[model samples]
Target: MYRLKQMNTLRNQIFLGFMLVMLIVLGCVGFFTYGQVSVLLRNNAEKHIQQTAVQAAGKLDVLLRQVDTFTAQVATSATIQRLMAQEAEGEKTTFAERQSMLQEIRKHEAYTTGIRSLELYTTDYRMLFPLTDVSLNSRVPQEWINEADAGMGRLVWLGLDPRNPDVVIAIRNVRLIDHSFSYAGYLMVQVEKNYFEFSVEGESADNGSGEMMGLFDGAGKLVTSDFPEGADVEGMLHSGAKTIELNGSTYMPIQKRSEATGWRIIILTPVNYAAEGISVLRTVVVVSVIIGGGLFLVMTFILSTMITRPILNLIKVMRGAKLGTLKPISVPSSAMEINELNNTYNQMVDSLNELIEVVYQKEIVQSRTELKALQAQINPHFLFNTLEAFYWALEEKGEEELAEIVVAMSGLFRYVIAKTDGDEWVTVGDELDHAERYLKIMDMRMVDRLSWSIEADEECRGAPVPKLLVQPLVENAILHGVEQRLGRGTVLLRATPSDRPGYTRIEVTDNGPGMDDEKLLALRCSLEKGLNSRSEGGNGVGLANVQKRLMLYVPGGEGLTVHSSEGQGTTVSFEIPNAHKGEVES
Candidate 1:
């Protein structure tokens, strides 16, 4: 209150104080909001990742069980037992015996691949191996075998078959014959790791790196792993237990799997994917900060405007004077205070002019000014010169069609030189005609090496667009493209009306040497940017400028676009909100 009294006479100081307090308050709120949102985001993401990983693990569990079930079914099959007996009861057969038995097992494959090799070992402690002797190096998984020795019997998961990586996951079954309860030779089917990886990865895009979907033996021996080469799987994840870890680096993982195989199917996803809702909260807070900041400015500006309406008007005039907006004393409005400022601005301009005149000679200045003036006239004069030549050709060859062409040419020149009379928009027909004439001029200049076709719905011909809408692009297509190549080029102009959202479209296509997407993009950026750069190739590349002008005059006027590919043709199109005949004037 005391400071307010001290700065009472300083209105801007008071307003600044208000704005500063608002900024600090708004900033504090925004900061706290960001924190809360970020925490929520993290929590939600972690939770979601955990859930998904669990589900994926469950699916993988089913796959492992299916493979196990199939492997058991194949081994117990009467045919496989008979094949094993054929080799077992015979005199020591050659390597062919095991291969033949293995082939017999393969013949009865389920959805899962059958065992690559079958083993036959007798209770007498003597062994019968397949042609490939698949049982040569096959050892019962120590944990399961130990349990089997300890009478911990049933079907159990063996970690993997090291001899063949294909059999990364396998099962061991101990059955007693004649009440002896002896260990039987194990039958292992190779499961393709990549096939499962591709299947799961296809569904869950980001599950690659952190997700470990592989099987380990019941004894917890490392068997098959999808973890990147050196990731310590045995220690990180163990059978019968699942854990979630998100260090907030790249991804957060939610793990799910079957304890049966010690086989893990983990869905490791980016924490963000899990925490999408939390991100939304953060977004809301950020949006709120922006909205609050905006509201603060709005309130402050409104308060200031109400309190200092008269003074702000004075300041506007004062600033305008310095900016030369009041040069030669031009403030046409009739407010008393405004008039007074206008007078003061005129006096300042007069004072400046008197001072400049005292310092420079007229001739040196006039020559420099004239050079710039002439340079400005060069492009327009050259363009007009081309138009004039085209007009004469039309008069000589197409006299009946010359009137509309002449009128469009006149309108084009008039819009350029005398811009005030040009409305914000003109009819589509006029714009199309202007494009035709521009293309015609190019064709005449290039010995008619190009052909053009104009297509538009009759109703859309009256759709309004900013003046000189299609002229520059059509000119560029011919000057830079059609004429650049010697072959006869086709320029197709099409207008389409859409009823779905009630929009009209204009498309210009060219069959000249179409540019690559990069060059086309560059041209588009140049068109949208409207930077007044002369064409580097001397082909009058001013498509950017015309599109920019269209956007300026027509609200929501995103009405120019180009599509092209090398060796293919090019098409440029734009959409307008409305197109009604008789609704627009040229």
Candidate 2:
């Protein structure tokens, strides 16, 4: 199995595919060439052996015909016939006459060099001359005698001589050339085994090493063979010319039959003799393939690297960009497509950087402008209303309480206007103090009709809260809820730790003529909908501005909430996150 992380690279895949194809092509060519060369070598060897056998068979046939012609000449001689006729009549013959006849017969004995010995026998199986202790009738096998008698003056092969197993002989019935064609006796010509050997003497001289040659008679009997030890003679005789393996050696057998002699000639040549050149060719092909494969691998490696190097470089740059390093990439490459891709990436990065800078500057300027506008709106309305009330108290009431109201009003303005460096949050204590100051001024204006109280938990006093967030709600409660009533009303402000962690709850309540469900619903909807200072109502921009500030500064959307009932009190509350923990002294 192949893995993506291992050989899944495009370069590796292409290299592997190329190598596979080369191997297949080389393997196919090598196999085909080897097979063809083997076949050619084998066929050449077969043809050579077959031609040699044909030549040997032709020579053997000529030798046998010469022997037969010599035998016929001896059989038709008049001198031998007169002697045989005289012997058949049982006539006494003188020693001198017998010696002359013997001399005449000896003249024909040297007719052929292939004949080892020649003998004549009478019809009664008696040798006429050149007598030996062995009788012709007793020495000859019955089968040979039967074949000689059946020949009726024709030459006949008698196979191997019974008296001398290594000798082969031809026999014929000798007859007188008379009107009756009377049989005189039998003439036998015996030849040594070397006579047959001379027939195939130079025929197998060119045969290669580990070659075996054999001759078999018509009945499939082994007449002679030059096969080495461990040769399977019986197996060879049973089978035709084909390849065989024996004793760990491979052989190709060639067999040919002679039409003249009814003899089979077989040759077994080792296969390796013909395969020697093929082995050398195989070695050359293998070496060439290996060297070519090595060169191909090296070239492929270089080419693949050339293709993938630029891609890897681009990937490295992309990784840097992923880590927030938006910088231009300048990878140089020979390929036009890669160069164009890098240029496009650089352009995109430049555009993005410019866009980020423009957006950041615009946001900073807008935030400052909005904060300044809010400040301007709060300063004029709050200071003017408080100063007018203070002036009225000084003119109409005594200066005893007016001085206190002026003092509180001065402290409230000082707290609001005193800017802290880079600090957007104020403590809950400071916010409650600002609200108390505003209530004090309003108390003086309402006199007996307005009563107000401010309460805050010590734990919540130090809670950091948005500036001017609570004071506006208290002013609205007094002016709208309590001041509108016919009877004296009470205004209350409270700040305490809320049930939610990391937050403080601030509520402003007024006991006066509370609104109906419709008015309360409308106010609640306006708070939830996120009021802005541009909004106009009985509460003017104060309530909306506080809600907007809370929404912007707080973590969640818990800005402001209002609850009221007819003939009951009205309460407005909101929660501030991170406003419950500070440097508060217990």
Candidate 3:
């Protein structure tokens, strides 16, 4: 039952439904936003890598062109040519010629820092001048000479040297100035690896960025890399793919090949680093969603409460109206619709109260009028004078029992009819006296078959009750109970101070044949049905009449309670306020 009620509340329904929609909306927006940000970051990273590769490749090209230009100047020099001719002719060069050739080459090397050493070789593959470095032997290989001669005086990039892998070597063929253009010798220039590193490092430093750069030869051999130990340079260069994954990290490789040097500049940028902002963005999005959802829930609770509070209050008032309580809504709501509804309910309550007031006044007037008409049926003065004559005549003949019967009958009729000009209220003591007079007549009629007792607490004796209230029950007791039974019957009437403050309890019990469940139910139903309903023939009319009159006197009262079974007697009871003077007047 608790679960059922929880499921049905308007607040829960609205709050839950709104939260569900919020979650879906936030989830979709966050998901798509995070995806787009990740893509944008990756694309920007790739573009940066491409830019770095381009700048590095351009610098390498410029450096290699500078080396080629320097080599060309040396090859065209008169001193270097005359020396190469001396070496070609198998002549022992003079010290001055040797000093002049060495001075000229050393002079060019001093202008640029990239050149480590320069060697001039003859057509027979013999170096004319060699440096003291062990890697610079006074010999040239057949393949190196053939490769240089094939360039026809143009520069040829030989990549890493076999003797010293750390040095890059380039060669140019020296030729005669005449149209014959005969080969004089070859000029081999050795460049330190630091020159390439300088260009790449300069570009990276300008951008305040750090990434792995590898220079690869046309043959796909790795020349130099910034961090060669940490990466797979050869594998990445030969993979033929734009991206590489190594050590559990994905990297995007941007490659630019230098046309002059036939060298590839490969820059590897880790994809995760480029997308680092995505992680922060994801955290922000989640927190925003949670905070937004929490605020929405609070607002939903407050709004739903505002909407449902007045309706619940109206329901409570309506439930009270079922038990004859009518009250207007005293407080208004912030919402116009709910306020209007409350106003309408209050208007309905006013209209219903007015209708009930009209009906109740009419009923009171009709009840009094009918009561007066019934009282008029017997001429009070004539009946009273006749009973007086009979009472005196019987007493004169020394018949005391007959005289007493006449006196009781005259008192009963006087008590009932005497209040026709006044309100229908009487003290409990007076109603009990009237009931005793009626019971005495009933005892004379039933003789040995009837017996009764009338009792009242001292505090209840002066309590007000409607006129003729107790007598009807006494009459009903004698007629339906004592008269119907063959054996002797007993009837008891009791009035006591009620447990409730300023109220009294009255009971009428009779012992006779009693009633079966069906008959008892019908009798109780008749009492509940009120005066308009026809009662079953067995004492129902009198019992219903007494119940109806009690309710009329005490509006909204539970008129009577009947307790009965097959062989047990029946007891009927009612409670009345001790003070009913204002109630009767109104």
TM-score of every candidate: 0.38, 0.47, 0.46
Residue 145 deviation, candidate 2, in Å?
Answer: 4.3
By lDDT rank, best first, the candidates go 3, 2, 1
Q: 381-445 in candidate 3: lDDT tens per residue? A: 88899999999999999999889999999998888667645557888898888888888887888
Model 3: residues >4 Å from true position, as ranges?
1-13, 82-100, 131-147, 180-182, 199-209, 228-230, 240-251, 270-273, 302-586
Looking at candidate 3, the ten consecutive residues that score lowest on lDDT are: 131-140
Tens-digit lDDT string for candidate 1 (23-133) = 788779878877777787677656655665666667666666676666566656665455444434454545655556555555655345433444445433234444333
Q: Put down candidate 2 lDDT per residue, 1-586, tens digits, no spaces.
A: 5575766877787677777887788778877887888788767766766776677667667777887888888778777777777777776445665566567766776666757777877787777654543556786877778878887888886666766868877888888876366887888888766676633435445553566667766656666677666677658546764578767788777677767556777766677875557778778778877887788778877887777778777787678668777888677878898898999989999999999999999999999999998788777568757776786778576785776787777777777676656456788988888888888888888889888888898988888887778888887887778877898999889988889887788999998789999988887777777655332245444777888777677645577878889989899899876533333222
Give the Cα-based TM-score of candidate 3 against the true structure.
Answer: 0.46
Q: How does model 2 fare in lDDT?
A: 0.75
Per-candidate Cα RMSD to the true structure, in Å, reads 19.3, 31.1, 28.2
Better of 2 and 3 by TM-score: 2
User: Model 3 scores what on Cα lDDT?
Assistant: 0.78
Against the correct fold, how does model 1 do in TM-score? Answer: 0.38
What TM value does model 2 have? 0.47
Ranking by TM-score: 2, 3, 1
